[model samples]
Target: MAGNDVEAEKPAHSLFDNLQGLAFGVIMVSFGISLLKAQGLITGQAAGVAFLISYSGGIEFGLVFFVVNLPFYVLAALRIGWGFTLRSLACVASISVLTSLAPRLFSYAHVEPFSGAVVAGLCVGIGSIGLFRHGASGGGVGILAYYIQQRTGFRAGWLQLLLDAVIFTAAAFVLPGWGVLVSMVGALALNLLVAVNHRGDWYIAR
Candidate 1:
């Protein structure tokens, strides 16, 4: 490996930097999720599950997402450590707050579903890179997936794909067929960005 790469892997981000990363990343994700929700679309993993529950019960997305993540914190604390667990909690809390406030804070004058999907994917995907680099996660399936991957070399990609399939299948029943299909496009975009950028061998100033 290059010296720069090795160095990049070693330096830790400052507290301010991590806080900035968590704040910005969570905001981006919250915006993306808000757009998806407005369109009756769903992504993958825990967020997707939260969306399903929220839609079915007419509950706020923030509340549903927060409640759904309760169990995952145990896994995060046990597997990742207190620092990671705390940071992840902060990220999730930011998401819950930002998502709850986004709709009220801004109005979407023109929201094309397909465009919303693309935007959501790009924003969340790119933002997630920042969050992960700062040693924080958006909680839910991400924490569980990492914990499982640590125990077994089963790869997070496969696990995410399976979860996406399950989420989409569930969406097919509750959401419009078109909404479910379009949601897949956004999910693909998001995952593709993550796959391309979030490499362990890449820059890792965590």
Candidate 2:
């Protein structure tokens, strides 16, 4: 029937709907990021680095996160398109605001460090997928890494690994040695979820 065909052709989400989805995704991510911060664990990218600085200097996580991501926008716009850049900006801003508001939201009385790391990983994993399906990226230095790979012949993964190494090294001073190791476990958890499910092959919303 013509009605059946018409219904099938409708977009799954309107533009406004997707924007809301993007905000929601970033909230979930910021919540997790804040939880991880409370535990003094690093996340292994721009966000992790922000957390590290926030811990050491007593600055707000939101400000550090927003500032660190500024440089990567140039790479994101050039390589990933303005839409992606804009969406990334939206994600960054939302997370920044949420990170600021998070402390007022609720303070954790007691959270086991390992448990907090695992929880942060799971939240970030799900949030990453939500952003992916909505056609946005959560901000990270990895954008610069991707741009470098495109221009030069280096792999983004290797570049990211190098950056992670530096982040963890700094984290060693901020957190206990075991906490640094658990941070790696959290990072692995986040990366594994993205690697396993974010292939375009697995998503067909377009």
Candidate 3:
């Protein structure tokens, strides 16, 4: 490629933006774990899979979760382009690192089922909205959601709901009923948060 062409194609992202996203990812993972432990609720997709492995195999949930998600990062890069992918990788890595390390750093883990669901929903909803605001994503459902958006221009949030349904359904069969129900409540909260917060036309950059 020509030098000028390559230079023009480069993606730009500020350090402040990256750090902000990293902070969001960390808090989300930390709270997510708290919610799960509190309600005995499982998460979706790779997280749900990780919960199963950790619950059954006596492995660290973060370790299992990271390993399961590792294989998909490359595909995420290819589809979403490098800058967004890198930011997402940072978010994913932060989530993994914190999930593994947070328990050692903090003491609270117990939570009531209803409260756990509320916190999990809020954490994911707010975190995801922040990521979207910065023109990046954590690259799980976001990756699939983008593809569907490109093809259909439909609401990616709805796509996520459908996808989460499938994952949570499988989780229900594997996990206890109350846990599954809590996850459902968490899902509802996450979708509502995204819908309410992500109106691009309404947002003004600070």
Candidate 4:
């Protein structure tokens, strides 16, 4: 009876709650991505790949980000659920649109690379937590990381850090040595923030 009462106190989120939460998450992430673009920096995970392609090909980051995430939806559906997959799809699409519109919305005159990286990391980390709490994600590596954590008791942030290391190394070929190092700082900040805060026990809302 006590367990039931405890569970009852933590009710699931309503549709409106989820919509707002997801919208907030998308806005935060898109802002972070815009910061990175402004600084000519790359992040980790699937977004990193998209950034690389956009930088090299002179293409739009939003289009590349959206396209790169397509394959991951299949994995998300198979491993998670259709509901989760759909929510994630919506999140990814919103980010794409927001990021595409970011340039016109605001422009940065000057932002130090290191400071910008740290701020961008914090933005993405907090935004991602919101998405996860609402039972959605940014798709791609986020889906994989969440699945691994749920299945193996591993930390999703740590797994992403490992994957980010690989992406950072590859970044050396595309970015200058100094740029790669600075990018690493951002990735570390983002992943560490997620690792420290994204605990299942800490948040009860589903």
The prediction achieving the highest lDDT against the true structure is: 4
Q: How does candidate 2 score on lDDT?
A: 0.77
Q: Which of 2 and 4 is the better model by TM-score? A: 4
Candidate 1 lDDT over 71-141, as tens digits, reads 98988888788887888898898899988998888777778888889899788777776777777778588
lDDT of 2 by residue, 1-206 (tens): 99567657655868887877787789878988888877777787788888888888999889999998998888788777898788888888888998889888979999887778888987876786677668676667656654565467464445555677888888888988898898988877776665565554344454
In order, the Cα lDDT scores of the candidates are: 0.81, 0.77, 0.68, 0.89
Cα RMSDs, all models: 2.7, 5.3, 5.4, 1.6
Would you estimate the TM-scores of all the predictions?
0.90, 0.82, 0.80, 0.95
Overall local distance difference test of candidate 3: 0.68
Across 19-61, the per-residue lDDT of candidate 3 in tens digits comes to 7766875577566765564455776545666777777678887
True lDDT of residue 72, candidate 4: 91
Best TM-score among the predictions, by candidate number: 4
Clashes of 3: 0
Off by over 4 Å in 4: 1-9
- Tens digits of per-residue lDDT, candidate 4, 1-206, equal 99778878986988999999998889999999899988899999888999889988999999999999999989889988999899999999999999999999989999999999999988988888888888888859998998888788798899999999888888988899888888889888999999999898788876
lDDT: worst 10-residue window of model 3: 197-206
* Runs of candidate 2 exceeding 4 Å displacement: 1-13, 142-163
